[model samples]
Target: MKTYNVAILGATGAVGQEMMNVLAERDFPLNKLRLLASKRSVGKTYQYKDQVIACEEATPDSFEGMDIVLGAVENDIAEQLLPHAVKAGAVVIDNSSAYRLDDNVPLVVPEVNPQDIQKNNGIIANPNCSTIIALVAINKLHEYATVNSIIASTYQAVSGAGVPGLNELNTQVTQVMNDEKVEPQVFPYQIAFNLIPQIGGFDEMGYSSEEMKMQNEGRKILHHPELNVTCTCVRVPVMRSHSESLTLFFDKEIDVEKAKELLANADGVKLVDDPNNKQYPMPLDTSDQDLVYVGRIRKDLTQNNNKSLTLWCCGDQVRKGAATNAVQIAIEYIKQNA
Candidate 1:
């Protein structure tokens, strides 16, 4: 058995807390564990099996002798800590979007591209929540039939924005129920019982940052630069789990049954397609689930050339998308380095 020292950056945030839960649940080997957060959360105690560890302010020296640093902070914080971790001879598995597109950094999903981790320049990136769930279900299909294009629309949860986003949604819902006017804070538009078509800031091309991530990150993970993706990411009024409606266009003709068969046996994906009585993947069913739930597989009616297939997928974004993937990277690093 190999043991390694681990540190969780942004230890008081939502993704950081989720990383702690995943580390405990997966029983990861830990010779030493450290929690680093902002000044506001410093000195806060987080317990695991009676071992109460105090959260410290994350600085350049936070990575001292650390074997692996699980980054659960924003892109700026990740950008700052990544080099520090590398300087300390610790590999950084970041959950932020900072390094996802860096030519030197490897954007990895253990199920889709475990080999990508081997290309890491001391930094591995966990992809966007919607992209991770979508790719986990479709990468197997892509393996058999190459993907030429993807049209995805995401129904993401409030939790994707973190705990404060959830609180803002819940507060607005309460205000509306009480016949009072609701005010939006964390989101650009109202998010209670409403859908905000924007997940991240808009780019010059009119696509939101969250929407473009699917295309940019997909190419890196699949090693397919010409893979075109058109996505519209929406923030829904849900607590957890992100759902996506995907219509994938393959280079070769693909049969729906064959695609289902391929996805049924794919890693990190759970096929739940049973449309006889309206059974398929849903945010409610997929919440807290580790596996990416995929269903609603069908041939695209508009594109009758047998090149396109539509599907629905759901998964716990914080787990499979952020924390679980980061922890898996840590495990892979241990396996290779130990």
Candidate 2:
């Protein structure tokens, strides 16, 4: 079997740890595994298979001789480590906002932009959690019916902000349940029993950076420069899984049955639309699954020519939204390079 030496930066963080699990779960070809974190995390050990490996302080030296470096670190750390990996001849699959919009780095979703892998300058970017989930559900439709516009709203999980956010949510929920008023920290406002319509810092236009990523990243991944999208990102009380309600305007009349059949066969999508039995995709159902569960399909009442279709999609932000996608990019790279 072919083998590759792999490095996972920020392995102690949520996405980093999930990257390790995804690698093992997918049985990625690894001859050596290196886990790197900050100085504060040094000397810590994480279990991989039956062996325990120490976490090293991440530096340029960490990439020496490694074939692939899975950059599961923060944006700042990924910025520092990515170039170092490139200098050391390692292919980097970076899960960060750092290099995503960089003209040189290919922002990729393996299912949509696998060919973009060939354009990598030793670094490939994983799309944002919101963008990844949105495109996965909408791309196939764009192909068949020519999606002209999209209006989407995302119900993001606290976990998107990492472990601290999850802790804050849980703690705040407990306090509120006990009839205590909780203060917000990780989020700008209280998130225990409330929804925060803003995610990431708001730009001058009032759209959060998270909301704009769908249009920016979608164009790159779908190779559709003219595609228009408007999104609202909200932090929901859910601990994991992200849900999106999308209204798509297609170019032609869409047969409802045809759309269902198309989505049922799409890669990484599972259709669960059976409202008669009160069946549809839910965060609770998609928490652990790799596939993007989609349902609640119906033609839009306000648009003609079946130009609109409303649907819901759910995916684990930590899994397909982060780690699994990175691993899939690496696998695609390895396959093409082979």
Candidate 2 lDDT tens digits, 1-338: 89999999889888899998888898999999999999999999989988799999998789999999998878887876689899999999999989888888999888787898999889899999988988888778878988878899999999898888889999998998899978888998889889999888889989999998998888888877888899999999998799999988888888678789999999989988998999899998888668888889888988666678988999999988998899999999999999
Task: Estimate the overall C-alpha local distance difference test score of candidate 1.
Answer: 0.89
Q: Clashes in candidate 1: how many?
A: 0
The C-alpha stretches of model 2 lying farther than 4 A from their native spots are: none
Each prediction's total of clashing residue pairs, residues at least 3 apart in sequence or on different chains, is 0, 0
Once fitted onto the true fold, the runs of candidate 1 whose alpha carbons sit more than 4 angstroms away are: none
